[model samples]
Target: MALPAASVQLYSLAKEFTADPQGSLDRLAAIGLKNVEAFDFVRRPAEIRSALDASGLVSPTGHAPLLTDELWTPDGSIPTPAPEVVFEAAAAIGIQTVIDPFVAPERWLTEEGVADIAERLNSAAEKAATFGLNVGYHNHAQEFVASFGDHTAYERFVSLTDERVQLELDLFWALTGGQDVPALVSRLGDRLTAVHVKDGIVPASNPWAPGAEAFGSDSLDQRHAGTGEVPLAAALRAGSAIQYAVIEYDRAPGDVFADIEASLGFLREGGFVA
Candidate 1:
């Protein structure tokens, strides 16, 4: 099969997007992107749909909260809407997968907490299926904080959840969690449906902490793709089942659009995305 289309997480340019969602997308289109991983689209499906139609880009996947009471971000949080409402909005906007971008760090600390996270998502997945939408989870480094036997909380959650609950691994965060990133991708197999392709120089004293620092830099230095310490090529080589290689950054290293273009070049030239 052809590799999945390259995508850019809109959150990588969250500020510019919030200011001009249409303009931000226009820039992406100019960069040759055909897909995007949307954030904060639950409350404005019609508006987003219109914008997407105008831009000629499709958002097959998007981020919204299904487990939490509120969706948190560095900018702010949006109150979590009912799953039925979320599904309705997603359907209206032509989203195929509704991946919960985050759950609190503490939720991954204990076996019981991880179990609840899985159970709740499994229930959500069942509900989402009714709308012809798939549910998934995106990881931050925090999920690796606590270990349950040989596996971490993330792995345990993987075991507890139904197979339909897809995964979108953030490669940079996985590295921050001190994981052998490529090996983890191979191990995840078909369950891994997407990856947030990122690069950065990780700090020396990294630890498996129970919070969002593992998601991105607390003190690490961000870099353009292929220039950072992350073995992005190796990780992508292992993602045999990955559907969307989303270019992202918690804090952009330079001219955001130019930075994204560089990563896109890396993915395309390296044949990581079709």
Candidate 2:
């Protein structure tokens, strides 16, 4: 397969992007990036699309909540919009896939819960197609905390979902969940279309585990890609059909732009992305 394209999650520079969408996108373009993965874009699709156009960037994939009533984040929860609304916004922003970025830990703890999650996503996938788009899920550590018959909740959910429901694995979080990251990537194979290429010193324990203390993104020691614990190069190499190697940082170690540039440099020097 051809090497995946390099993209950055706009959430990596959330504050800056929120403050000046056009200027921030321009800076990313100057850094030689041609694509971005949008975050929280449902409310401002036209503005983001305009900014992307001005900067000669395109957002082929973006994050939005799809399978839940409320979207969970490290910081807090945000109300979810209807699936149709999400697809309309994504289409407006020229996004080809709308990825649900997170689900609560509790929901992944039981076989029934995992099935429900898959069912909802499969239903969302059907709805998404009407708008000429696709739907996917992005994982954190929560999905790994539970298992059924030797398969992780993450894996089980994968098996249960429709073939059209894509997957985006977050490397650092997979490591945090004590997974063999590259092996998981290899197993995911073609269904894995995108990856959040984040690197960081993983937390001592699964923060999303039951009874774990609450933590926020600011508390994480996220670093530039290939500079921390995640086996990014191996993971990227293991993917059979990954189309986007997306750089992201839950918390940048320094200036966000410079941090993003450093990660992008890793992708280029390693020939991991086109």
Candidate 3:
């Protein structure tokens, strides 16, 4: 199937965005990006909107860090608007979804805990609905690893969250968690609002397998989309029903722009997207 015009997560280039938001957006736009998924804890919606407009890109969704105790801490918080403010911003930006990228550490386990998180998400979804936007949870490997004995915490979330709540599956993380991306997508169906398109490989060197980097540098775990071990084409096929597929790389080997450009080339020519 031919892929739609692609969008990228701005956080992947946080260094550049921080140094020069306007220049970074322009550079990305020049690289053929029609849309962007921005992440800035300090920048307001108005500031983002102005920058995006200047760069000739639109944001159909925003990365709203999930509400958790960790977010109350310094390093994890994103400047989320108040519910009313978020609604107003969504209305102005034409954003349909707000993706919460990480579950707070304290909130990642147990049936009751999962239920509590679901209730919170459901409430957010409800509030967002009033603004014509939806709330979604974005996953990481932790979600897949944190399990309730038999089922993974991710499974718990999927099973418990209200139908209105959506998911933004990160295919690479799904594989890292040892879950079947296609199966999960099939199960979730329309509940999947968007996806993060990237690739991962079974590490041959295993940087962190035994005695590796002092802090365990397993950078090989993540690679540019379509260039690693993940079955990206298959994943994309499964997400055909989704509304958006945003390209991302948590760590770029060298140039962030080059990584994104190469991934885009692969996505367009490798049959994941047109």
Candidate 4:
């Protein structure tokens, strides 16, 4: 299947956006990006829309807490009011899919816990639906490793979540968890709605945990999509169900814009986009 034009994952350009969101977005658009996904956007809705209209960029995906404690005052508790506010903000900004990237502690692990998460996700999806939005979950390596009962967290999530709730498959982390990207997508079927296109070259010493100072920095040596070891073509084949393919590299060599340019060039040559 032919892929859509690549979308920029704004987390890769978080620094730039923080400094000057409108200008940064315009520059990204000038560089041939017409779509984007963001964890948090600095611009207001009107500002974002104006910039996008000028740049011809569309933002379809958003990231926020699913049921995290941070939104609430206390630690490890979900606040009733915050979800509504978050939902409204995303909907206002023209975000079609709002993703909860992590499972809160109370909703993590155990069969019952998995079921609870499914129920919560379903509720969020229902709420989002009223505003013409879809709710989804994005996975990291942890989801594949975090097991509950007979199934891994990813398995449980796919099994228990309602059909309406979708998934944003982070391919690099899926690989890090020792799962085949296409195989997992095939198994999940239509529930897989989006993807994070990232790659890495981990040291052989500890492929999953490369250094002692901070595992976060080394677990995956974030790099441009096609520059690392990920089998890009095979993964895209598996991602037949996806609509938006988001490029994200948590860390880049040299300047960030250059890194993004390199990634886009690689994808264009590979025929993922025109």
- Note the Cα lDDT for every prediction shown: 0.88, 0.94, 0.72, 0.71
Clash count (model 3, backbone only): 2
Best by lDDT: 2
Report each candidate's C-alpha RMSD, comma-separated, in the order given. 2.1, 0.7, 3.9, 4.2
Instruction: Give the Cα error of residue 260 in candidate 3, in Å.
Output: 0.5
Please give, for residues 1-274, the per-residue lDDT of candidate 4 as tens digits: 5565688788777778868877888888878888888655422566666666677777888777765545321113333336677778777777888888656433444567777778888898888888888899887665654576666777987887789898888887777766777778778777787877777773333222223232444244677778787776677777656787778776766577778878887777877664
The candidate 2 region of ten consecutive residues with least summed lDDT is 71-80
Please tell me which model should have the higher TM-score, number 1 or number 3: 1
**Predicted candidate 3 versus true structure: per-residue lDDT over 136-169, tens digit per residue:** 8887665664578777778888888898787889
lDDT of 2 by residue, 1-274 (tens): 8999999999888889989999999999999999999999999999999999999999999999998888877767788889888999999999999999998899999999999999999999999999999999999999999999999999999999999999999999999998999999999999999999999899999999999998999899998888889999999999999999999998999999999999999999999999
lDDT score, candidate 2: 0.94
Q: Estimate candidate 1's alpha-carbon lDDT, on a 0 to 1 scale.
A: 0.88
Best to worst by lDDT, what's the order?
2, 1, 3, 4
lDDT of 1 by residue, 1-274 (tens): 4587899998899889889889989999999999998888887899888888899999999999999999876556789989999999999999999999888877888899999999999999999999999999998777887899999889999999999999999888888777899999999999999999989887564334533244333345888889898889998888778899999988888889999999999999998898
If both were scored by lDDT, which would come out higher, candidate 3 or candidate 4?
3
Q: TM-score of each candidate?
A: 0.94, 0.99, 0.85, 0.85
